[model samples]
Target: MYRFTGSWLHKALVRLCASLLAILGLKLSAFYFLGLLIVLGLHREQLLG
Candidate 1:
């Protein structure tokens, strides 16, 4: 019974960590893309005006 519970807890912990990492990765990528877009816009304005 203890072993079964331990295994279950381990699985849950792994799943939690994986989900957290996935969320972090998504947020980082989104921020990076947004920054790139803003930089491009600024560069275009500088070139045009």
Candidate 2:
């Protein structure tokens, strides 16, 4: 397991990476969004620390 630490820059990079991945490949886009769903919603605690 991993936790996203640091600051707002990390958050921006995550969003940037999400958009970039979505634009780069179809398969990656699917997996990235699903992971985003799991991280952003299902496992909110991971980001709070």
**Candidate 2 minimal-lDDT segment of 10 residues:** 1-10
Per-residue lDDT over 8-47 for candidate 1, one digit per residue giving the tens place of the 0 to 100 score: 9999999999999999999999999999999999999999
Regions of model 2 farther than 4 Å from truth: 1-6, 26-49
Give the true-structure RMSD of model 2. Answer: 19.5
Q: Residue 16's C-alpha lDDT in candidate 1?
A: 100
- lDDT by residue for model 2 (1-49), tens: 1454455668999999998887878877789999998778756776665
What are the candidates' C-alpha RMSDs? 0.5, 19.5
Residue 36 lDDT in model 1? 100
